[model samples]
Target chain A: MTAQAAQADQLASSHGHLVIIGGGEDKERDMAILKRFVELCGGPSAKIVVVTAASAVCARMWETYDRAFRDLGVTRHVHLHLMTRHDANDEDLIRDVLDADGIFMTGGDQKRLLAIIGGTALDAEMHAALKLRGACIGGTSAGASAMSGHMLAQGRAELHPEKGSVSLGAGLGFLHKVVIDQHFSERQRLSRLLSVVAQNPYLQGIGIDEDTALVVERGVGIEVVGEGAVTIVDGRAMSTNVAEIADHATPELIDVRLHLLPAGSRYGLPGADDRDARRIPPPLLEFLENITKRNPIS
Target chain B: MTAQAAQADQLASSHGHLVIIGGGEDKERDMAILKRFVELCGGPSAKIVVVTAASAVCARMWETYDRAFRDLGVTRHVHLHLMTRHDANDEDLIRDVLDADGIFMTGGDQKRLLAIIGGTALDAEMHAALKLRGACIGGTSAGASAMSGHMLAQGRAELHPEKGSVSLGAGLGFLHKVVIDQHFSERQRLSRLLSVVAQNPYLQGIGIDEDTALVVERGVGIEVVGEGAVTIVDGRAMSTNVAEIADHATPELIDVRLHLLPAGSRYGLPGADDRDARRIPPPLLEFLENITKRNPIS
Candidate 1:
């Protein structure tokens, strides 16, 4: 198939927006990152559902987001409690879930959040809202980590690739083929993300820095929002000593296609057209182009 | 490179197809699942050869399937059996297996079948037929379980998800990343399926219900055919205490994604697309489009 046709086929199935934020989002002042979410949800009038299942202080998490949206002039909003697996499939919540224009998740424990809702009817509805109803789905910190189909559940914060540092789990699947890590720069989690990418290699690891968000447009490219950068670790062509490493041993990662994308930059979705390849964001195309440029035909 | 492109490239190297059926596929009436196997084999003109190595009652199994194929208008159908491991390399059988458009294996003891044919010339020919010369391979029950890279040989039938309830071994290697279990819901083998996946969350466990088939389209998505469901237990991101829990102790499985797909649903090959996640008959998609056609998203 033509590259265009192939890219089109990949995106033909995607019908939603994803707003994945790093931890320590600004709730006060401009609230620029969260406002982008509100705007994507069809402005202040859109009905939004905030899932605070990940938080230990669920009520506080709910109140915080509730007040944030209210200040943004959102008229209709509600908090979804998925404290148990049963609550994730509660019949009464189905209608509200279906009607929602925006589905936002709060930060806390991503593992705890997914444990209750994974594979539940509520999870299905959330998928439906995104895939069928064109909803803008936003998440922060732990919420951001759970957006991937294969989520990186746990890993010790490290600056070097540790063999046994990273632990993975399934996520809500807004994004596939990529694992997200929040508090990237702030937590110095470059190694945690690197560990997974080195082990799998085929999987792309994306680490979102604190106060920043990666806004994924439906079936298109991604835009960086907020103050910090989004670090992408693509190891598809990398060489590593992962296989030779002992348990908890640090491994060497070489020739990995790493990109640190700062705010105000946009990147082409993988395999899509690269009309703006030579732009501010040095993503797939630009990087590949640079390689070709470095070694000229002459 | 795009992961999809990489995956497609890997799958394309194997120019073949697999029609994996759960136990007790219907031979009488419409024989929908078997018909699908025939269709995948390039219709009635296709040469079909059945291997009854797994069955203790080989002749009876052969007769039933032979008659079923004949009724479906297949004229060039034959059965090949291996009474011993030496019989697997019988020169006469080699030509038939290598030339056959479709190679169907019967239900019985997978271990017994493997002991006779594994690594033999006939087994090599089957892989050659599947990989080198594009052929359709259909399997039922034990035939299905032996198709995975790591086959589930034996497991206790249990209703509740239990621990240490599974036994694994090598197989024909038709599918990787998944372990197959036939006679699933009919025999209440969910626990057995869960046991294996929980132990190694990386491997997905697929329990195929009776009279159903999971049609794997090479390098593409999968389509479910027949009367029952295909239960997919994905624990890739599941949080479990398997490491801390003792053997035979029921480990807690958190964040596992489960899907019970019935007839005619299409799922993305390795990565699933939830748009076709629902159970609906084949001819309903057009109706779905017509109903939703009235209103177009702006």
Candidate 2:
């Protein structure tokens, strides 16, 4: 199979849009990020649900997002605060979420957010909404962290990557194939992200800077929005000395492909663009080309 | 959180049954294993669909399984031959699978099975059938390997575990939390399974021997059937020197919990049994207990 055909096969199942934002999205400025979310949610007629489960100040967080949506001319909006697992099973809450055209998650503690809603009825409903109903799922900061199936829960920032500095946890899994990190450049989390990709090269590491968003139109393409750049650390062809690093010690990675994509840049869905201007090594390019040919997915 | 509550929480979302069989299940003798699958599919009235995508000799494979189901007094059984990705997207085929009471997958090459059907309309329909329509999914060997979200694609049979010895791939993901290996004792694949768990301790390792099956009634419990024992390698509490191992070198694992459960033995769903006769280390037991307590799921 050609690379194009293989990418098509990988994307055939995706139907929803994932609007993932980095931390500190400009809500007060032009609100471009939130506007993009509202636009994707089908404009003013969209029924949007904001989940502030991750925030310690749930009510305050809800008010902020609610006001933002209202200012954006969204008429139908609701707030869902699941403090405990039992709340995640509330029929009324589940109904509201199922009826939503879009679901937005706020930033705080991803662990707290997932602990309450992970593997619950609401969680299942959210996935169903995305898969079956084509509803847009948007998140920022901790919210973005909880979008992938395998999430980077917490980690320390260092110039050099470490073996066991980063920890992983289960996310809501709206997106697959990549581990997402927020506040990328501001927090200096490149090392931690590199460490994660070194261990699990199958997963690509996507680091979105503050105020930026990665708009993933399922089965179509991924577009970058907002101010900063989205750093993509591809480790599929990289060699790592991770296994040799002692526990909680620094790790050494070799030949990792890094792509610093600025706002307005887009990549083809399912596979990286082969004709991009960036200079990818011949061997690495051949390796990627072989994946589709060898697999013959379509 | 008590064990019962934790079990309840886990079962809250599980709505289907998965009969995962290791390779070499008896088909000619008493047909005990095949009968179990039919029984789970609702017996004589069961509408079974046999997926022969994994086998090279699809016709012969289909005939063998078709005869087994027919002999078991099954009235409605259809064959689904997904030779290519296009077949997996056939609306008629998806409809047939959607109406299935049971879906049986034959063993050959798991990669072939996934390559043809993974991320297709048929795959989505199958997941919907299991999650919403209460259909049973049963697979043998290659079929069983595709049951988990993270599958142990290929590996060598060695006594001492080595780094980078096993290859992992994406499965259909009907089951989570465990990496399954078939033809366990027959192939001596314990070391590879151990190595996988050491690197990703969040996932448990289950090795099923040939002629054996793990009957997973989602949200309830898993029961062992057929002949031989099922090895459950719990890695959550194990301390591994994996970070210090050289590339492709043997790994050193410490305090890994090994449970050799024979047929007729049952454990609670989600969490391993706490009161088993086999002595689990205090730290491991404490860690297991803390999962339910810390998360307070449901």
Candidate 3:
């Protein structure tokens, strides 16, 4: 494995973390999703900071979560409503972040979340807290997408990657080097996400399926949660002629490798498992290999 | 001056090109913008290729341009109407690009434009045309933003060089090396742009004021157009604690400098043109000096 791969392995074992909760209609049925987060966070009683950036969620989404938070006995749950029209530099949001033991970003528009919180004291505070305190940060749906700097807003179709179909918007940047795409499986957004990563080789793309979450512990790597799989696209390892595309004036074939890890599996860079980094299970690896084979650059 | 600066100078002076009109208010206005583009190309009667990606003009934007196409005392006009639905990818769009003489991107959501044309055969065609034919591609608000691969979707109102307020989405990727922001001066968006460039120094950040456009000729250099100034934030000269930010924390000041240039001004990188490269013009030099002086350690 390359040094970056090795470094990724190190991240898997670190402690600073960000987790995602799948947000589909069956979220309530998947109580296991919430339970896993609580367990990883050392229980629901853990002091938590909840930031609601999604407008789609209202009292209903909260009701679904109230039980989870209560069952976990998280009494000091602080919800920071960050969707207000205030500038991203709002002192209130920054202070809330600084004081929080754990930070939770709600799902909605990655653009809105990044627009409101990115580049501000709040964004800085969260990064510092994650790195220094090993504080946990979590999100769902749009929230999951916000975990990474590269996000998929909307696209033409999953058939092929078009110009703006696979968009890279500003995410929370919590997963700074990676791009996060939500509702992966159900949405069949693989093509869109692939297009994004291909354009930006510097980014690693992660796609989270519904009812699934990837609990990423800084220095500790990633732990999968709930049902379905998490698709990881690492373009850094691929070879490309993107710079020469114009000269050729033809659609070039790109070699992209993907990893489809199912729930409970752990994936980190090389050496990630000196502690608990899970190896790519045979089944998942086979599935990913099949995908690349079927989609072999045409 | 650095060697890159000198190279930029030589490139700017050597390339004679056609202008692509991408943004404006309406087709009539877009057409007027196209007319301006024709003037830039050579004269009002110059043969122009209009690539219509504007939803407003896709089906109808061409009809409106009929008069100008005929009345410009000329008849050579290549108009391609490219539009994609939310989940549809039509191959014809790419074909449209391959046959274009000069390309014009219409205004709308830079996101939408990217969605339809992103990684398709069309994107390669446009890029090839530019590099080989020296086609002038100009976009207005959305069009201009799409010129750069790192296009600004939206930003927070934060006016500090912190992190997270400014979010970037994927654009056409035609301008891969730079990150661009539009409607800059009108929205008071300098700090956000600075924060963006600071986060990723490998990419240059440009903020184009409303009505103003920065025309960059690949082998030549860049020239400003329209009403306002183009803020160029070159971070390669920066020395920062990127290690801290990479570790999921915030960036500490090290050494950074920025340059803000008005229309008609230019910057030359090494091996380009060292002398008469706009002379660094006092105002532009002052802008660069201020960034370094403001924070010795960026």
Q: Least lDDT summed over 10 consecutive residues: which range in candidate 2 chain A?
A: A289-298
TM-score of chain A, model number 1: 0.86
- Residue A62 shift from truth in candidate 3, angstroms: 3.4
DockQ for all candidate structures vs. native: 0.01, 0.01, 0.01
Tens-digit lDDT track of model 1 for A166-270: 899999876667899998866767658878987987678888888899887654566778887776767776655679768876554434555556565665545
Q: RMSD for all candidates, in order, please.
A: 22.2, 26.7, 18.8
Worst 10 residues of 2 chain B by lDDT: B289-298
Q: Write the per-residue lDDT of candidate 2 for residues A49-140, one digit (tens) a residue.
A: 99999999999999898888888888899988788999998887668897787999999999999998999998888877777766788999
- CAPRI-style class, candidate 1: incorrect
lDDT of 2 at A5: 55
Q: What TM-score results for chain B when candidate 1 is compared with the true chain B?
A: 0.84
What tens-digit string does per-residue lDDT give for candidate 3 at A1-298?
Answer: 7644553453344466677765562444547776666554445445666676564564555665665677666676766665554734687555667755577666666677766666667777777776665566778887777766566665543333333445667655555566777787566665566567656877766777887887765543556777666766666645433454442121122234445455656645444443666454432333223221211111
Predicted structure 2: lDDT: 0.74
Q: Which pairs clash (backbone N, Cα, C closer than 3 Å) in model 2?
A: B11-B219
Ranking by TM-score: 1, 2, 3
lDDT of 2 by residue, B36-90 (tens): 8887776666789999898899999999988888888887899998789999999
lDDT of 1 by residue, B1-298 (tens): 5644543454344346788999899999999999988876767767899999999999999999999999999988998977998899888766788678789999999998888887788878887777666688899999999888789988886433456778898888777777999987667676688789888776778888889898775544567788776766667756656677667655545445445455555644323233554333322332223211212111
